[model samples]
Target: MWVCLVVSVALIVARLALRKVRGQKITHGDYWCLCAAVSIVGRLLANHFLLIYGSTRILSAERRIELLKPGFEVQASEIITGSKLVLATRSLLICVLWSLKMAVLDLLARLIMKMPYERKLLYVFWTALFLTYLASIIPVFVGCHPFKKNWQIHPYPGDCVIGNVWLFTYEVSNILTDILLMAVPFSLILSVRIPGMQRLRLLFLFSIGIFLIAVSIMRIVQGHNSRVQSAHTLWASLEILFAVIVAVTPTLYALVRNRHENTTYDKSHLSMGATARTHPGSLAEGDRYAARVWTELNDSASRTDTTSIEGILVERRYETSDVKL
Candidate 1:
């Protein structure tokens, strides 16, 4: 969990740096990423408390009875504290995961803003996401009766510790939203005419969300099969770690591609000049052809920018050729 937290923080920092280097304004998506970071920190702290107090859910029936016996007041208090931390950890985990969903949605909305149909589809997605988010959260608060029992150490209902209904609802909603979010970008990518490599990169970037779904399912299975709260927390942390990585990957790829293109442009400019000087006879014809190709590529790139990934992925490049003399 600590390793996941550290890597998540580093990725968030790198995301900000990448935007600065690219001269791109920080968008709503970036704000969402920051929000996720804060939630992740809170979750980590809650996990720490759980560690110190030790989750009540992990205690066996005999162990719990032993702790509740007279003269075990200190142990009882610790169990109560860990039980509360369990709730806190679950809440923070939800916050971090949903914040990431919003981040990706925000970016995808911007990328496809000009398409009226896609925009409508995005609205549908947004509505579904909100509804599912509520579904996932409501159980956290209402799943247990006499809410205080949520932290009650003994003589509390099983639902107070781990609500099966909450687990089922949250997992289903989580996976549903992930699939919906991934579909939007994927459909857009398929409808457009991007280079094969660029298309592949975009597909791969969005495809990483599949792992989030897998992690969510695993969390549910672990929760049902194991009595250990720490195991559940571990799976939750892994989900968040993968979410952060997926959120930052597109921007990182854009930054690297931009640098490589700039270098290639400079080298190509120098080579073009050398070609004109060495083959003076074909200079004018070659110049005209090169100029036309450059204009076309630039025009196509500009048009693609409106719908491309952060306006950084679908650039059309000119392939320089030797002048015929």
Candidate 2:
């Protein structure tokens, strides 16, 4: 869990560095990612204390009674503390996952900003995600009656301690939001006219969400098949870590490709300069003409807004009617 937290922090830092290198302004998505990093740290600390307090151990009703006997006051106290930590962990886990979801939505909103219809669809996705998040968290607080039963030891309701209802609610809501979030990118990809290779790369990057859904299913299955609480934490941590990685990958790809293209252009420019210096008659004229055409193309591209993955991949067409060779 600590390792996952550290790696997530590192990825966010790398994302910031890439933005600085590319001379791009920070967007809402970067702020959301920062929020997720803080939540990940909190979840790790909660998990640590939860283990120390011995709250993660599954206990039967008879075992609860045995532990609550007169001789085990310290053990009972530890169990109560652990139960509260369990609650904290659940809240932080939700914060971490949903922050990443918001970050992705922010990027998607920028991608389709020009299309009013697509922008409306993005708003619907935002509303769906928010509603599902509420559905997932409401049960955590209200699933157990009397509120104090959430941390009570002996004779407490099963829903308070076992949380089967909350778990099932969270799993369904989580999977539903993930599917809705992925649909935006897939729809944009289908509607755009990108090169085949670029389209394939975009598809693969967005398809990482499928792994997140699979992980959610595995968490549910593990929770049912095993009596251990640690297994759930393990899967939750993996899901959060993978979400952060997926959110930053597209921007990182753009940064690397931009640098490569710059390097190639610089090398070619130098080669043309050397050739013009050696043969100054016709080659010099050709070099000057090439520079003018390059300037015009750059000016045209600058006029178009290419801030998102789809924008970056879509081919730009330039008219050459005004350029005299």
Candidate 3:
């Protein structure tokens, strides 16, 4: 328990520190991944605590078996009990929050494509993510139940209530939401004025997000039974991690490109635009433009008057045109 806890904490801390060093803002997908990582840690702690303190507390092996009477079925070790159901419920709420975050992100992306108001679109995405976070509490309470011994172990009594509803909703909503998220970003990417081949290449690169959709599909398929005990947190974690990578990779890739361009321009006599010449077999004029703009953008970044910090100017633009073809 200690080892897992320590490792999870270290991973989380490292993730945060890296983002901080890179000046990375939390996107909607990043928001959910952070939440999932925190929740997994919390769930692990709670489960270990329950194991230490609950029905099996300090009991000898002989005594443990003696406690299990005939007709009172003892489920498989991994099956969801009331406590695990509660954890599953919390996880579901996080999933819903992810869905809502994506919804707003898609809306904002649509707005950016049509209206070209990047700042306002970003603000809308921020507001939506915040509001979606608040709404997560609904599923938390609705799906989770407190730990109570002998609460619903017997199948005939049908004591289960809270978890089933959440499981169903979570699975269904996630499927739809994952597909939506995978699709929406493409709309923005494809609409970029870059040449078709370059646009296609970028589109293909971004399409890597669909792999997350595959993860979602697997999670949903496996989640149908509503037996929280059987639920696989490791598989769940994979989905969360991949989805986070989806959101984070683009930003990181853009930053790296910009940095590289800036470095090249600092050493060369050619203008930033000259760096945009295309390589063979690669599709998309946007790629070339992006290549150029990134160089110019980096050059602009290099020209910042670091000594006169008081009057420094920062020109940070997210417009598609700035992506250059």
Say which candidate scores most in TM-score.
1
| TM-score of candidate 2 versus the correct structure, residues matched by position | 0.77
Q: After aligning candidate 2 to the native by TM-score, how far in Å is the CA of 275 from where it should be?
A: 42
lDDT of 1 by residue, 199-307 (tens): 6766887799888888888888887746676677788779889989877776566565553333432333344332332322133433332210010011224232232
In angstroms, the error of model 3 at 24 is: 6.8
Q: Write the per-residue lDDT of candidate 3 for residues 135-177, one digit (tens) a residue.
A: 5445545442443332333232133333445444554555555
Rank candidates, TM-score, best first.
1, 2, 3
Off by over 4 Å in 1: 259-325
The C-alpha TM-scores of every prediction are 0.78, 0.77, 0.52
Candidate 1 displacement at residue 94 in angstroms: 0.9
> What does candidate 3 score on TM?
0.52
Q: After the best TM-score superposition of candidate 3, give how far the Cα of residue 149 lies from its true spot, in angstroms.
A: 9.5
Clash pairs, model 1 backbone? none
Candidate 3 global lDDT: 0.44
Residue 48: error of model 1 in Å? 1.3
Between the candidate structures 2 and 3, which one is better when assessed by TM-score?
A: 2
